[model samples]
Target: MESLKNLKVGVIGLAKSGLAAANFARSSGASVFVTESKQRAECAVFLKRLAKGVTAEFGAHSDRILESDIIVRSPGVPNNLRVLVQAKRSGIPVYSEIEFASRYISPREIIAITGTNGKTTTTSLVSDIFKTAGRKTVTAGNIGSPLADCVKKITPRTSVVLEVSSYQLEDVERFRPTISAILNITPDHIEHHKTMRGYIDAKARVFENQKKTDFCVLNYDDKKVRALKSLCGAKVIFFSAQRRLASGVFYSNGSIVVKLPFAGYSIALKLKIPGRHNIENALAAAAIAAAAGIKRGAIEKAINGFRGVEHRIEFTAAINGVEYINDSKATNVDSTLVALKAFEKPVWLILGGRDKGAPYRPLGSQIKKKVKAILLIGEAAAKIRKEFSGTAELLDAGDIDGALSLASRRAVKGDIVLLSPACASFDQFDNYEHRGRYFKNAVLKMKKRFEKK
Candidate 1:
């Protein structure tokens, strides 16, 4: 519902969010220009989608971003860029794509979910619950599509389930959700946010614009997340996997249960995914669904039918009595720690990639006790070897393929060769999925190689 007749909007980065924001702005009657740091040839295919009112500038001559009334930044782009600062100095605002898209959601509800991990699984679960409750739901943000791309599809009956990240929340001015949840807060994105406080502040912005009428679901087990209650203006509902909550969802002796503020009895739901972390995710999803007025039966049905997202401790193949697990989505120290707990075996763990400023020293205890040997790859290999060389047998395999082959050879019967690289994938592959696919392919290829022998 934002008026956009004569305004000129500059979209930073020629990525998916950038293209979607440009297209949306143009469709809303604004003159749009896209600025990408890459060369024109690098973005030739994406530029083909530009229409009459939209212009694109690629590479080198990119200070043109400051000429617009507002700047919409892509998720991974840093906010401290020279052009962004210059624009800020000139009184032009820089906002995330989610912030821009939220302005267009008039009558529909948005269930925005954020945290260090489990955002994707919890968001997908909530979306499925809404769909099972017979509501039109669209999944976006860090999960399905960019928030800007999902904007036009919003109707009065449609609800958006967004998996928001700290990067997206950093520059949000009015990106408030009707029902927001922070599943948990752990050490993540320190490379981008610079410090712990900066990261916490960014994640807390998801509920900054909420009113007393809105609802915010929080993780009761996470002290940092539980401490955010006073900061949120919305009615806070807590979800815990360890203890019984008098007013929210939790896990008891053997089942998932929930107790509403007024209910005399609690309801226990079924879960299809394993792992304690996933159970917490299910509980968090249930809290969000219940706060949004989704039926308890619908919630139980969605949780029962929900399978987990790919690349997070996903089984690739079993080769010669050895199991290869792909946890390519484990991009931080805490996530990798959770993945290690899922197995009770002699693990040949693969750990490396673009280091996110997380210390590998904290993971040494788990690696020493569980992992038989560790293969290091990507940019963080040396750093990981430094921290874990004393804890386990360390092998610098240099890259993913080399690491997988080395682990495959070392792995014996009942061994787990797990790829839980506690770092970002940009160091080697296009993204986490690409890295996960490569790991799976290598595992299958190794299996085939052994079959012929």
Candidate 2:
């Protein structure tokens, strides 16, 4: 490993990834300084975990950060932040935590997954497939753990399965993965990236550094994703849930069929996860595992055993034959559409959160066809209500609690009460996970009350 001795590093944000980056840099012999926009009280828990000899500042980014040789930014920090822009102008390099961590780990294969949705599930599934094949693997990046924390501890044989985000990809430089997969892209995160094209550009960066020897996995069902194949320098492998592929992985009838130039394999579908989106996710995972040299049987076994991830269409409970689903991770219109498509039962969908610059108009037809009611919550409730006012039974439910309470009263047998907010949860809760958990706990609490009755 190259020594970071005598180097000074500045880390922005004090969230999970930021703290990990600060600690990792300090341990790597770099003089680390951590800065966060949140006050000391807000970041107390994380600050307590900061490594010894690492100095920190809270509530602002100071000139101290500008003095560092390089700046490592958390995903939460905006790329165009004044301090970061100034640092770039001053000739100091700025990188996302993933990029910084990638510099230290060489000769280890990385399977990076990115898309508007299904990143976590696909990443976890890929990691599970690798483990089932008896390979050492670490799943990190946007799926909660930072790559920085995983790098030093991982051996040369370890396979890194990363759940990358557009934010993380925005600053990547010289960070090349052995294999990269773009599950599917839709109109999301436009608020941060400023335009749909900008969001697509950032997602495309996942495979930008790959060479002919590397593998790029493309989603054949998505035109935007399929077109990206031409931009990739690596050997392209297409995976599809919509059509059969003669040269890549695809879902055919009731099985996942793999048709590589060298060999062919197929696995029958017996997934515990619901939705066509998950079938796509499984296909993507299988493609990545196959590209990594994992056997088809191991890939099939892992895919069959995988149950799904939390906060993304997770089934909470069924009280009085009414099901409650927590899909708080559906923080965009496309995701909520996927949730709606997963169910045949009449849905009492709890929609709205902090708007992410996407419109709710696209959900109108689905809501009219499949929804019993629309319970609006969070900051985007008004905007959603405006677009969907007459499409279904509209409820001005203030938040998750109100939405669940209203749904419990109105929903009947065989109906679904879904918390699939088509917007970010920042306005109401800490994050999507917190929002999902709160919805789930409230549902469970209501279920217990039903038992007493």
Candidate 3:
């Protein structure tokens, strides 16, 4: 194997992926240079902290970047960008971090999970299920540790459970997963992919390099995911919460039942997580687990004990007889719809963030029926207010703290103050987790202050 020794690699965009690429290139004995569009004080401060050997130029320096042998395209940078175009014209190879990283590490078994929603939940659940079955499993890629970092530790017995994003899957070459899952495809990341079809195509690449011997677990309930049946070379296993399956997992009379081909008995299983979306997630996890040769009993045990991921319909605290729920992970309209469905009481929804280019009409209708009041904040606040004007009482808060204050004051007994932002968290916080933590902390402060009163 020819190591990427003394190779000149240029990283475009100074986001997490870009930084990871820079670090990876440095480790591989390559000289790294990073370029960013912003030359702000914050960016300058950040660039100053990079390795002394690594060089960085900010504010539209395409010429400096175009000189490198290989360009590591960060997910945030669009393909149509002038810098990428110049690199292409120069005949310089451009690859995503995942594609670049795959050249170094050798991993036998990879389980890649991609979807518009439930990717994190399914990936975490699948990894947990494999762990319960006493397998040496590590969950990485798009979730926490980058795939490159995780791949460096892969062994013969290690099963890599990767939560792949559309961006990561977009440029994969020979990076095939032994077990691939397309949980569901909805219109998401439109701002990045620029089109719904493009987003779907990026997700579909999870199975592009997979072999016939590999397994592709798909959501039978989602029509878009169901359409990929013909495209997948891997053996198809369907999972549904709404429909019954002859050889997969389904919901029957309030219990999850699985009917496998090898063992044709339906086991009445209990799930610790709430909501129909989670049931579908469990089914997906079970399908992956079963395909990985995990026993049914182990799957059931893991499902029974798994407490669900944080920031997804997470309960914060009850203050003044009102329940505060943090669902900052619902960054898209479809996810927010799921969160809205999970609630029975009148909801005081805290919505709005960096818009993902999804229409809010469907969400407006749901708010008209279910939501009592909405406290809007961040970049999409105006757009959200306009969309839900006649349907619900929309209040603009301008910030997360203001939203929390208004929501707490407006929420009545038995009513829910839900922070289910139907947009990306980039405008208000670091990410969804950061947004969720702030909401939780605000709720806690409000609880304590009310108690003192």
Cα lDDT tens digits, model 3, 184-221, are 98888898898888988898898998888999999989
Ranking by TM-score: 2, 1, 3
Clashing pairs in 2: none
Off by over 4 Å in 3: 44-52, 262-265
**TM-score of each candidate?**
0.96, 0.98, 0.94
Candidate 2 structure quality by residue, lDDT tens digits, 1-453: 567787999999988888998999899889999988888998888877889999998888888899999899898687788999899999998999899998888646988999999999999899889999998888899996899988777878888889999999988998899999999999998889999899999999999999999999999989999999889999999998888877999998899999998548899999998998999999999889889888888998999999999888899999999999999999999999999999999999998889999888988878988999889898998888788766898999998889888988888999999999999999988889889889888989999999999
RMSD of each: 1.7, 1.1, 2.0
For model 2 the local lDDT of residue 135 reads 87
Model 1 agreement with the true structure over 386-430: per-residue lDDT tens digits: 877678899989888888879776788999999999999998897
The clash count for each model shown is 0, 0, 0
Clashing pairs in 3: none
- Candidate 3, residue 16: Cα displacement in angstroms equals 1.8
**Candidate 2 deviation (Cα RMSD):** 1.1
lDDT for model 3, please. Answer: 0.84
